[model samples]
Target: MAGIWAISCKPCELACVRQEVHARDAEAQLVRLASSDNVLSLIEADAGVLAGMLCSTSDLADDEAVSLIERVAKLVTCPLIVMCDRLDPGLIARLFYAGATEVVAGGSSSSCEPVSSKEACAKGALRQATSAGAVAHSKEPAKSASGMDAYAEPARQVHDRTAFHYASSMTTALDEPDGLDEPDELGRSDELEEPDEIDGLDEVASRKAMGGRSTSSEPGAPVICAIAGRGGVGTSSVVGLMAATAARMGLRTAVIDLDLMHGNLPALMGIDDPVDLARLLKDSDSVSETAIEATAMMVSPGLTLWGSLERPELAESMGTAVEQLIFALRDPADVIFIDTSVAWGDAVAAAVAMCDRCLVVGAPGPTQPESAARIAQLAARLGVARTKMVSVLNRCTASSLNEEFALRFEMALSLHSRVRIPDGGSEVSGLLSFGRLEDLARGESRLTSAIQTCTSSLLKELGCAVPEGFGKPSEQDSGGLRIRLPWDKAGEPR
Candidate 1:
């Protein structure tokens, strides 16, 4: 069971690869690479299959592509599949000559092919590699390049639909500390890699993040925080979609509105006079799971909601209470999402500080990237590791300016991975504005599918199992390329 490891600094590309890999073989374990450093580490540690997707024309040059292929090929024995965006015959030849086991050329502007075509190309490459006896030569069948087990114990015992069931069960087991036996002196955990930090914090910060609670040692849901430097970037909308989607997948999910001043989740969710998170925070000294649960408005089965204060008077005191609320929700929800306010302040910082993972939503604009960079710096100062943060390009349209903004964000924020959310047209906007999010979640629009893709990527990063029936999201034209958000030129209304 030598699994496949997909290496890419781009979130969208790696996501495409995961979809192709899973569709081709559900039992296969997919590992992601965030940087060239991770690539070096993976090459040194494990002998497994590898897949790499080149950047779009705007982000990557031909020489850089050659250099990357050469460096990776020189060090590893695994089979390699490379997908090029332009599909130039010369570039394809150069890639194969540089050590790529198979070169794929379908993402070109001329092809206008869907991601399914790219998936098929990758699948063909993998099949050729397997037929050529690539997996037979691996050092260990069950180990991946990261030294983590490629598949769980149940993976070997199931097939087809039952296979995903086993995988989901495996994810549940991994999320629970009690489900695992004690590790040896190395502080290791079974199944997954040992956690280097608690919520991306060092030893001292991990202890402080717990606020004197022992919850860090317990098995809990992953807390995800979504933030945008300013408003109209779809931060709250993204948060709602993710929460609803996770709930539909059978995970108990909770959405905490940290936007104390002007929270829109209550309105967007169509909940009239929802429970204010401030009420739960006022009794922070005696806050318990029961109290938190009592205040939560049930959006659907497995999904719970909590909104911010209706007015801004108590905004100042809600900082510490945000941390307390997150701590209490750890036991009940499989994933807790904090929809932080658009502004940077104590509340936003507290939410970022407490999250296991953070999604920075930036629309295409000079100011958005700058604000995103500032948020990244703030997170770094608060001890949140850069690896735990991902930039999400929301409301994206096709434009070179959008690409520039995304590139600036990547460079300024030092972020390796990014997910793109396409601009859903007026119809999608109408649904969001009128509190018809469930329609988008169950609908087939590009926005709906993109959110699903984003959710899958996050779940994979957290070692959770993606639910069944998640078909591949629709790909963009010109190799899945997208540029700007819908409201970048004009201020988008909430």
Candidate 2:
């Protein structure tokens, strides 16, 4: 509750004042706002309470008080009640100027003995408090005491959440090689948008962002990232890891698992199962940020997730998901991961166009030459620059046969930055079995090292500052490889 400072007041006076404050729910909402050495603390805060501390009058520190008032005003989300011991026109005026939403005199009409000049002071403070409350209650929606309307009530503000924090201690899972089914020659998976179908990438981007009909004013480029590959290749795992890492790095990271084929990122990351995306699509107009965001549970203070839908048909409604997905990423997250499917449909193409980075994961197979080629060619057609693209070699192995896979795949490898991932082995099993990779990232796992090196390299290329201890970790952590005793399967190959 908001404090009413006592200055040599009689016992009766304290009881009378206490009764008045306890009677009003608004007064109960505000607690004391304390500032000392430039640090302010709000105590016993009620969402709608108004609070103010006493300022001396004889010396008339109006300018100083005004500055304090303005700063404090920004903190209170509800209307303010400014209490003064004695009403002075100058003080009242200064309070308003300094951003006190309301000002009043503090006192009661009763038989309490007066303390130091308290008789006058008490009356004035009561008057100000009463006036402040009345004025605030009359205003439409009652602007918070600080008179801040926008972002004034932070706890109440809501939006769809994405999980992509640049966290320090999370694993970045690599998906298996992407698979491609041969279609007609015109089935060019490489070209997200057939050049002839749309005039340019901007045109397709415009349509995808607008969803054919967003009347709201255009917003900044909606934050998005594309995590895609074929079924069972762990597209969501990579998406989850990106989100986990981003969150740890202090960026509010979010993951929008657009994998309508099989929604597992939420479960894999140990988050809640998703609500129906098709149902959300049907009610797209009603999909307010608050409702949509509620679907995601915060993995940490910095990370959150908006999971994917379960049904195969849910992907059919992806056209609408793209539109809303943009709004979800606007939160203060460092990164946004969009886990997608292997089938390169128009929906996937639209997502690829909007992403800041496109990571394609693949394994070493003779067909990888052809599959990677199709992905790179399609990405190029979509106007994705070579610099913005990344190709990760998942579960890489060297077979005696087809010894020159890298050379043959040079055509696809030339299109973007490349990271050769090492076998995560048990780390992968841990993520799948335990639903967390914190231990794996902390261990001296080759895959973890590769992820740390590669992700930082990509970040540096993207012009973002390289994070600390990324490629450099404590020896006990990931910096140095562990030397196990001979009995501990020490020589086993990953």
**Residue 365, candidate 1: how far off, in angstroms?**
2.1
For model 2, residues 1-494, the per-residue Cα lDDT tens digits are 34332121223345533433343324443222233222234313432333333322222255655565555545443333344455564566456434443443444443211111122223322112211111212122222132111112222122333333322212121111221111111111233234443343433333322221111222222233544334444456555665565555555556676666766766777654555555555443434334444455566666666656666765765653554554334434444567777775545666665554577766666576567657755654443433345676665533422326655655455532565655566558766666674445445566666666665555444333445666653355443345656564567654
Estimated TM-score per prediction? Answer: 0.57, 0.50
Backbone clashes in candidate 1 total 3
Q: How many residue pairs clash in all the candidates, one count each?
A: 3, 52
Clashes of 2: 52
Pairs of colliding residues, candidate 1: 395-485, 396-484, 397-484
Query: Tens digits of per-residue lDDT for model 1 on 1-494?
Result: 64565545355455544543443345656666665556667766753444322222223577777667666665554445555675354554455445444433323232422222123222322111110111111122221111111112111111132112212323443355442222221122231132432222232122222231213344345678887777877888899988877766666677888888888887777777677666756453544444455567766666677777866888877654565566556554566788987665665665665555679888777587788888765655453444457788887763534666667766666564578888777877788788777667777777778888789767655545566556356556325656666665568742
Worst 10 residues of 2 by lDDT: 179-188
Model 2 spans > 4 angstroms off? 1-203, 206-229, 282-286, 397-403, 463-466, 473-494
For candidate 2, report its TM-score. 0.50
Give all candidate RMSDs, comma-separated.
16.0, 21.8
List the global CA lDDT of all models: 0.55, 0.45
